[model samples]
Target chain A: MSTASVPLPNWITYGLMPLLNLLVAFFISGLVVWWIGENPLEALRLLIEGSLGRGDAIGFTLFYTTSFIFTGLSVAVAFHAGLFNIGSEGQAYLGGLGAALVALALDQYVPWYVTMPFAVMGAALFGAGWALIPAWLQAKRGSHIVITTIMFNFIGAALMVYLLVNVLIVPGKMAPETRTFLPGGQLPKLDWLMAWFGLKLGPAPFNVSFLIALVMAFLVWVLIWRTKLGYEMRTLGISPSAAVYAGIPYARTVIIAMLISGGLAGMMALNPVMGASARLQVEFVGGAGFVGIAVSLMGRSHPLGIVLAALLFGILYQGGADLSFEMPNITREMIVVIQGLVILFAGALEYMFRPTMVHIYQRFKRA
Target chain B: MDFFDIVVSILGSTIRLSIPLLFTALAGLFTERAGVFDIGLEGKMLAAAFASACVAYLTGNAWLGLCGGIAVSIIFSLIHGFASITNRGNQIVSGVALNFVAAGLTVVLGQAWFGQGGRTPQVSGDGRFTPIILPFADAMREVPVIGPLYANVISGNNILTYLAFLAVPITWWVLFRTRFGLRLRAVGENPGAVDTAGISVTWLRYRAVIAAGFLCGFAGAYLSIAQSAAFIKDMSAGKGYIALAALIFAKWKPVPVMFACLLFGFLDAFANFMQGKAVPGIGEVPVQIFQALPYILTCILLAGFIGVARPPKAGGVAYTKER
Candidate 1:
């Protein structure tokens, strides 16, 4: 049976269905929390307070949101082109390397403004360049994008480890990290904005990258919804054969879509390297690339939805840390379990309750 | 050591390293052959590893641990079948979700039950699988090349290693020879044809998934109890993805799958060997290059440089009869 048997209103389809699914997920997560002998509601309360209660907490949450936004947008763009770009993690890793190279080479000589723009360009170019091989393989060589991207991620990680340990380490340092960037290369934090508003703000990594992420989200919306290239990409996603029949060059669109997708994923490096850490750290991308997949799925591939979803995950990350700290028994892994539950209900089992809901709606309409 | 001795040692290491890949790739073979693309092999293996370790540690019985692993893996496989088959959901999305769930649940439960770094207590003696020496191992040691080969490479492996190799031929027979195998293969190729011929597509697919679960369980058990003696967090470590790559490299055939696993295993062993040793012209090539070789090779192979590899006709598509 098809899911379109009983038509529902836009409000119920978009808003209610997701809400119901989320409630079920949270309920199951609550049972798991209780299984570990902790009060789920109390745990959730602590999570909210930890993530959004104070200025610093909010700052940290926003900082994480910045990373997710870029990666989520990357996945979304690729999705619109009928490509599953799971290599965002690898692309972001290479992007960090690119940003680091530029900052390291020029930080002592140039000012922050000059270094930042060049660093951004380097990251985008490198990230896009890394993604190009997989795209070309998919477009021309008949390789599956998913498998190639996944393999590329491992290769990228190994390459980074080699470079960090043997080539880029500081002269006498033991740590597998690059030399810290000079103050001139560092992006300015948003503490000044808080001060101007006469608000007391703790030192947080929230910086100019957050603003850039927002701007990029808007740009993505315009590009995807309004441009000729966007139309072709969406058409290609919907029906490749039809798009080919309509004179849309399939290979060119695939390459362009992946380039844009990779560029966005690469931009994620700016958050940790330039905005937060001020140095190239190993595994700096963490699991943000994978999280982007969930965010993109939850947001239904819309820019606004992605922004909101990213913020939600930011809360989960920041708040989950606090929850685990408070309830030592509820370890960090439990939080991951909860997040996995959310992904399960939100993605795989998305239409689980749809048929029942649709039947109920039809009956109500008849009455 | 001489070149012959080095080759023997590397070959031994290759067999040891490839056991897990062999099991997982064969598991993927069964599921994919039945038209369900499962990328969650890593997660299932992880969960099974944890479950087996926990049970073995508690009961001090390796056999019981193997049973526990298989049971847990089957439970997960059924959940996957329910989502993709009954609910008609996207198979990839379901597999991915289950993977995340498995990853999360295993660690969470491990911490709750064991309370020691999310690791189960180390099992010793009866709880762990020790190496078994073959009957002719001692006698064959004096036969020059054959003696060293049998003693070094063939003998002294855990029972599961032999089971993994044995699975290759058995899987080949079951997939190509048996009536169930014929129906399973037909379902993957065209479920509608099977349905028209009076076969139940859902039941056949579910059975295929259950069989996959059993193989994955054995792979996980081999990791925790047989190979490592403890369940380390994230112990699978992308071996499932590598196994998937091997499955693709083998083009879904059982005999080629074993060979592909051996190739990957050799690459891994070579990487470990080259870590501190010096090469003639290269003069101690970086270890990372060898470590990255399998993935890089898989990418090149997948790029159609070797040949085009085609999946099952109905793979990854949810089958629903038109009303």
Candidate 2:
């Protein structure tokens, strides 16, 4: 599975390979749909229509894409520093707590503009704080980042449950959630954008946070490609011994990378808390953190690639819902199976067909 | 009411709760020893639980359901082996993807078959594992500590619980004493050496992974058929991760793994016990603290508080012949 065996063009390696993998994954998923007595082509059509055909559907797709973008960037940043931060889920959970605390304290006293910036900073800080311990341990204490992050995820979940149940719940409310934010704390949606363009977009949760996600993605690109720190990080990732020989501080690079990664993951809280829910809730992070890993892998840890991959997953989510609505046999969980197949092909078994593809290309070039 | 009764009841609950953990941790031990890092134990257990419950409901035979669970789990393990071993894929990504696949497929299949919100029909009578009481349990009722221990803490558990305990020692013996164990451990530590010695590293890893599948199958069957009557969505919860943590805490040893599972089990039981109880000084401690204890402890253990724990040398890296 070495890339040096047969040289491939950049476009074929980056573009055609992933597209082919995705096609094969979808083909297998179609078989699964067929097994359940549903038309795979119809299911796929419904999925596309449900996600992209209408303004409201597009809005929802982008809304989901926003969260994925944050988490995906989080994972991608860590990958550059040779770290696998599986704890983004935990970091995002704590980030929501940070945002919730800020909103809770100042929502009644301040305007949305003031509260929103503070909440975003608070989420990033909290998320970074949660990740710092694991990063430090990995850097200084030789702890495996993967195991520590996983442990932190469970710990974060337990901590959230305790806080929500015992302290954060509204008075006399049975549900384990904080009181809803005042109007001042709620983020304005992008409905104004549609209105300004004279497009009648239906009520959608797509908010200003989506714009924040775009800004963050662009910032990540600049951070990774246009900075000295990014050069050091990539060098450390490619070969640790060489980086050490060049006098790059391994520990500092690891911690800084994780902090930025954790901060990006933390920023994901803005989407659900300020934009959609307007309240702090349990399990709000939901599995977006885990999905980010797949997104990062599929995207090749590139910021532009991550956004595209996130949008693809966003389509799966919104369209999967529509699929279930149209076909009774194709339940929501079936879409997850499809997503898993995609992940399997694109991430884990990514190089399964590469050797054959490379061989064919080399032979065709000679001919 | 009394201290003795409390102790007995807590111990009983500990044994019950530790059953699934013990099975999973041991399952993880096999694969990890062979240098395959598997975080998919949770996914495998969930899939097996669903398969077992579905088969048990359909056939009304607990043993057959257990077999069905093992078969499904083995099939999944083979897929994992194919991806990670044969293709030399990223093990962690492969595991995460498998978890998602199992999580999704079980629900989709369960809904397609049972149509009961992704739950199989509840099995009763022979379809479920019944509690087995040891002989002379009635006569021992009048006796003291030993009697209570035997009757309350040890007896009346499903056969799987006993087998789970038995597996710990068996695993210890197999890992330490057998030729296969030597080859497995050697392969994990240095696959190149094993390859040079004319042993097939790939086959050894595959066998270890398949054995892990068998243990995970038992764990899953025990959850659905013995612990509960039917499979529920995400019933494995974080147990698979907990088992992975336990494996790390044990430093990949067999006996320590059992103890780690028991500690986690005791913590879980303690959490349940403190849910409504009030202490004189603290006054109704939050149950979440105790629930979170095992994970926190695992993190601390991994952070070099306990001496540095070393994994197999070639654990996460794919073995390339040229390299």
Cα lDDT for residue A47, candidate 1: 92
Each candidate's interface RMSD (Å, one decimal) is 1.7, 1.4
Instruction: Flag regions of model 2 displaced more than 4 Å.
Output: A1-4, A196-198
lDDT of 1 at B108: 77
Native contacts kept, each candidate = 0.56, 0.74
Q: Which lDDT tens digits does candidate 1 get at residues A144-242?
A: 788889888899999999999889988899999998899777888888766776644587798888888999899999989999999999999999999
State the local distance difference test value for candidate 1.
Answer: 0.88
DockQ of candidate 1 is 0.64
Q: Over the stretch B1-323, how does candidate 1's per-residue lDDT look in tens digits?
A: 99999999999999999998999999999999999988878888988998889888989999999899999988888988988887777677677777878888887777777787678789888888889999999999999899999998999999999999999999999999999999999899999999999899999999999999999999889899999888988899989888999999999999999999999999999998888888898797888897788888888888877787888899888888764
True contacts kept of 2: 0.74
* Candidate 1 wrong stretches, greater than 4 Å: A1-3, A194-201
**TM of each candidate vs. truth:** 0.97, 0.98
